[model samples]
Target: MAVRELDDLDRAIVYALQENARKTSTSTIAERMDVAPSTVRTRIQALEADGVLTGYHAEIDYERTGLQLHTLLVCTAPVPEREELAERAQEVRGVVAVREVMTGQENVHIEAIGRDGDDLSRIGRELDEIGLTIEDEDLIRNEYETPYDGFNVASE
Candidate 1:
């Protein structure tokens, strides 16, 4: 389908949905906008078709699920070694997420979850060996208050 620009109503719908996907159902959105539910449904389907609404999934608390450790590793990668650094991070036992960043000097950012401090230290050391200067480390105590992204963007 062709990509069309979002109109005022479209932006409003998207904004409402971004705040709470479930709250803005076809009927609710129609009622709020004084339009027909089918119209709302059609627009929503079109939005999904256009890839604006990718998907949805539940958010679970990792700590409650025995995943208490959260560590952010901001490492600087030397020239032409990002792929190798990614591989090394993947080999780490409890690295949940590793992403190549676009920061001017920083090469990649790693978000890892280990069982204990020892695991974190192990990961830190691994990065050091790879010549990646570990810039910062922080514990993620609670990540529930982030802005609500109506669509699903999650790991497995």
Candidate 2:
């Protein structure tokens, strides 16, 4: 697929959505960008169709929901099977997210949440069953995110 080039308006729209998609309405973006609401809506549709904008996800705080352990499972999978195993790992209980890195080793990173050590062990075992060699595990303390500044049209 050809990459879709984004203009200033598209960048600004993406920046606004990244800041708060749920609260950022087309009308609000229109007001900020001085464009019509319909124009903003059309741009958003185009962005989605082009795959520049994916799904909007909620920022979850697992610790507040009783899942105390937020762990990063560093695993290594054979390069040929890495993608398949990463997708399969998502189906494992307690697994929240899986990332595939383009490296020779420690190429798969799995994010999982568990109530305690026993739950984490089960998740680890399940990952191992799926052909991922567990290399290390780290308990996450905190995570933070902010809108990408490059997409901030005002900055340009």
Candidate 3:
């Protein structure tokens, strides 16, 4: 997709939303940016329509939710079929996310949460059934996120 140019107001809105999409209200962003709430709302709608702002996602702590196993399943799928296999991997029970990297080996990375070893084994079996070669499995300790600094253009 072609990149869209974002102005200071657009960048500020995206940054604020990224920081806390659920809690950050349009009014709040307007207040922070000293703009009209309607303007912020319109800009947000435009951003979404333009595919600049895709979706808001919750940061979940799977371990706290009693699903102890947070595993990163590194797998390789035939380059021709990688994207399709990644989408299929998302349907697997216990699978949380599937990332298709632009690499030959270890191209598909699946993040999954399971209660026990058996559950993880089942997930792996399902993935294999769909023609992904499981290269390695690593337990995820923690993940952290921060909003893109480039979106803080208003501050700069």
Candidate 4:
């Protein structure tokens, strides 16, 4: 599909939603933007119809939910097999997220999960046998947490 243009208000609306998806309402946003609620609704519909507003979900706080380790299982694999590896990696225990990124000199990236050192090591070993080279590892610190909710349309 061709890329459509976004106006200032549209951008503002997207920004507001991205910040707090659960809190804002069209009426409330209209009030802040000094526009009518119907206008707010109209713009929102346009955004959604254009496939901009994908969806929403309640982002869970893993640390508070008994999730122990959150680490990436970076893999160096051929570009053609990225999707297959991602699908397989998802079934591994404790993985929070996965992506196919431009990993410097590598082609794909896989995020693995573990609650402790053993889990990380075990996953690494399994991945290595499958040609998934572990590039780097780190602890899942809350300091770098993002709610992962697609977007927010809450008030300013």
Candidate 5:
């Protein structure tokens, strides 16, 4: 499908949905943006069809759930081993995210969540056993996120 250019109204709709996709209704967005409810719905449908509006998901707090440690593991492997190493890291118990990074000293990055330092160390060992050399580790203290801030450009 050809990409659709989103107008100002469409931008407003996206911003509203980003704030709260499940609770925010089409009518509420229409009232806020001063457009018809059908217009908001139609635009949302088009956005989804165009792959702009992806799946809605809830962001869970791991600390609240008792899995408190959030660590980023950076490792380097032989070019042939990068894919396999990343796949193996994903199977690790505490791993939350894994990515093959191209531009950096490290070739692979893994985000793992654990109950504590021991759990994190166990996860690191699991990856190390797969031939991933641990180059660096960073513990995430906190994260502040605001979704779709760029899509709210209509207000600017």
Candidate 6:
């Protein structure tokens, strides 16, 4: 499929929506960008159809939600087994996301949230059983995110 290019108004709309998708209505976004609400709606539908805007999600504070332990597991496996290992890691309890890194010594990065250290330990053991050798792991102390600006959008 051909890549659909986002126009200037699309970039502004995206930036506004990224700030707060649930609260930001099409009319609000259009008003901010000085465009019609119908135009904004059409562009948003087009963006979704072209797979540019995949999905809207809420950023939850896992720590506040009682899942206090958050970790990043850097593991290595044989190239052929890397994808399988990632998929297996997801099946392990507390494991949320498993990203396969194509290049580097650590081929897999697992993002896990747990109730405590024991929960994380169990996940680690499960990964080990799946033929993943944990090179290193880090406890996520905190996360900081900023509103997405239109910096990534190409200028016309």
TM-score winner: 2
Clash totals, every prediction:
0, 0, 0, 7, 0, 0
Against the hidden true structure, what lDDT does model 6 obtain? 0.84
Q: Per-residue lDDT for 68 in model 5?
A: 76
Candidate 3 stretches greater than 4 Å from native = none
Q: Judged by lDDT against the true structure, how good is candidate 3? A: 0.94
The residue-by-residue lDDT of candidate 4 on 50-148, one tens digit each, is 997888767666657665776755567766776677667666666656677865445556655565788778777776666556777766565343433
Which ranges of candidate 5 are over 4 A from the true structure? 1-4, 77-88
- How high is the CA lDDT of each candidate model? 0.74, 0.95, 0.94, 0.68, 0.85, 0.84
lDDT of 5 at 94: 90
Residue 79 error, candidate 5, Å:
5.5
lDDT of 5 by residue, 1-156 (tens): 667788888788788888888899999888878889998999989888889888887877888998878888999877777888888889999998899987445899998999988998898888889888889999888866676776785558
- Residues 18-77 of candidate 6 have per-residue lDDT tens digits of 778888899887786788999999999988888888988888889989998889999998
Residues 1-156, model 2: lDDT tens digits = 889888988999999999999999999889888999999999999999999998999999999999999999999999999999999999999999999999989999999999999999999999998899999999999999899999998987
Q: Over all chains combined, what TM-score does candidate 1 have?
A: 0.64
lDDT-based ranking: 2, 3, 5, 6, 1, 4
Superposed model 1: Cα runs more than 4 Å off: 1-4, 78-100, 121-133, 144-156
Which of the two, 2 or 3, has more TM-score? 2
Per-candidate TM equals: 0.64, 0.97, 0.96, 0.73, 0.76, 0.85
Best by lDDT: 2
| Best-first order by TM-score | 2, 3, 6, 5, 4, 1
Global lDDT of model 2: 0.95
* Two-way TM-score contest, 3 vs 6, winner: 3
| Lowest summed lDDT window (length 10), candidate 2 | 1-10
